[model samples]
Target chain A: MILCDIGNTYIHFCDTYKIWKNLPDEINKKELSSDVYYISVNSINEKKLLKAHKNSYNIASIVNLDTPYVGLGIDRKAACLGVENGVIIDAGSAITVDVMDAGNHLGGIILPGLAAYTQAYRSISPALEKRINFGMDFDELPLNTQSAISYGAIKSVVLTIKEIVGDKKAYFTGGDGKFLAKFFEKAIYSEMLVFNGMQISIDKALKKHKEQK
Target chain B: MILCDIGNTYIHFCDTYKIWKNLPDEINKKELSSDVYYISVNSINEKKLLKAHKNSYNIASIVNLDTPYVGLGIDRKAACLGVENGVIIDAGSAITVDVMDAGNHLGGIILPGLAAYTQAYRSISPALEKRINFGMDFDELPLNTQSAISYGAIKSVVLTIKEIVGDKKAYFTGGDGKFLAKFFEKAIYSEMLVFNGMQISIDKALKKHKEQK
Candidate 1:
């Protein structure tokens, strides 16, 4: 089976559930001939996916949105899928903590990502450019304006997620997922959550296809 | 008695507890002989205070910063002094929510102001400069990226504050005070909170000065 996950910035195509970034060019050279192809895209950049399959023959296909479920932004959906009853946190360009219970998806909170918050204050106030530090102590009194902004933004998101999730299992994913996982004792990190969800969807689709035949 | 309250942005001097901003220069010039100049500067440009009193010969010597308070931002100190017992929110370039109970003061939360959030995203990604409306509608989604950011940042702060000060009286102040006040159901707006805090400080200082004599 071939799986493709498209995001706001980059596209990932993988044959197996390991790191795709380290894959060799030979993987790209293979003719696309899988029983089922699962594709996910958030941006309008479908051309990248089309180019990859240009040399391949026609095959069964399944497409899905990259959020809230399979093909969804794995950062969010995986958190939702990973925990049957808890909070899913995706801390990347932005920090999103969503709560899911039973089958219903409770709303989540989104804040400026840690680095994004620091970069933001620096850009707007030229005076604060030299003072942006992402990993500084938040509880200590912020020494300058830039530290104040960064520390405040980070703490705001952390505290908000903690408040909503309470004692529930907190699942962390995305770019800074592992980094934020340290803050919460209940947090669990699964790097390929989005990919895993996509794989599950592909398996389900193929099973249904065979059953129909 | 001449009371001068210096804040982070402006200096407000008043003879009584009335509207000082709209007071005529002629009134200040004529009746203010300054037997005792009660001056309070809450992390503001001190030079402006000196310039204002450069020609006031009867200024029995300006006394400042001799209070028992330590390690608090001038704006926060001012806000705490202004409110009786409630959550004092200072919404400016950043938003700080300080809680005061009875005569003692409790610590608060600090985060980026609304404009700072939008400006940060706009600087990093110029494509998000379009104006966007913010509300509780998850179905509509954010058409322009800027609205998505503004909605996220504003909602984060509001929700956090609500969690912090549940069922407590809330008071809003600062540059963006009015804009933020609309988010809370029972929040009271005080445009001159810092100045009022300054007044309280001045009163305490004058009483101390008189007792010392």
Candidate 2:
């Protein structure tokens, strides 16, 4: 089976051995020869992807989890469902840190990612428009303009996540997940975490469909 | 005598009895019958203010503080000079947290303030465009979008300050300083912190000038 994750910008397609990204308009119907499971945040692209594959399934409807957070994104929900117990950090455009304990989502907070951070600083003053120094020393307070802003942008987010996760095992995913995971002693970085969630939901959906038929 | 703090937007003036602000262009030389001592970040306004008052003294040339942080703002330096031992938080357009111990400046970090934070979220996605909920409970993980973003913006900055401050008294100033001071156990909100620093520097300069004479 093929797996897909549709975002605002691109549609990511994954098979058994390869994963590639294409624009929503570039999706070809003739390419899919098997069942496809997907989760999407973009409605228009989701419909296009659904039309490309006759057996396409949006896993959002199938994935079940306990969460009290209203308006929580499906991507975050899927990541939580991927893990039975742990903290989930999806460091994409926004760094979302969610706490999952024994298959239940406790709650989470949202932080702007690196680009968003840079934009925030630039908006305050043009002099503060420096690239985030990810490699700066976190142990000592920064003593320079670049390092000071860097410490604020990176350390503040890291400290917030650290305080929340505590001793809980943290599961990291998304583009910047690996970089963030390094700050914690018990962090697991998995690129396929969202896909893993989609697969679980697909399994449950197929079983329910079979029983009904 | 009069004290003035010139910023990009306004020129704040303080007398023994009252305080008022005026635009840089609205400054009148004839209105200043007494000596005016000022510190300014806006160079063009600084020149304009200096030309307006013949007896005006820029306090940036007088205050002495031991700091290793290169390119630190003069306003921040003044705030540090105002206190002998404490953490200084100037929460204006940006929240600058500085660590000063026993008359020595350790270092500081900068975070975007409320307006900048709002802009950051809006840039990420319009759905995230919500005013910062400063009243959100810090102890609880947020269960809604607004609270989640609020917790991230406010709590993250507060926690960062908390970890650095530890047992030190925090001296808060700037526009948003009063709101942030509530989160700390030992915080003093002072509106005249920068002016206090300017006073200290002026006294020192006068004593030195008398000794030379």
Quick one: best DockQ, which candidate? 2
In model 2, which runs have C-alpha deviations exceeding 4 angstroms? A8-13, A20-37, A42-59, B7-12, B17-36, B42-59
Q: What are the per-residue Cα lDDT tens digits for candidate 1 across A1-213?
A: 655555444445556754453122223535346632434323243454555565422222442322332222343553465456777777655666666777456556555667777775554334345444557775554545545555567666666667666898887866677877888988898666656656655667789889999
Model 1 has a clash total of 6
What would the C-alpha RMSD of candidate 1 be, to one decimal place? Answer: 8.1
Off by over 4 Å in 1: A1-4, A9-17, A20-84, A103-109, A127-147, B1-87, B98-109, B118-155, B159-171, B175-188, B197-213
* The candidate that achieves the highest lDDT relative to the unseen native structure: 2
- Model 1 has a DockQ score of 0.18
Native contacts retained, all candidates in order: 0.24, 0.83
**Winning model by TM-score:** 2
**How do the residues B1-213 of candidate 1 rate in per-residue lDDT, one tens digit apiece?**
655544433444555564353122223444445632433333223454444455432221322222233444555666687666788888766677776777556555566667777765554334444343555454433323444455567666777677656788889976677877787888999766765666666677679889999
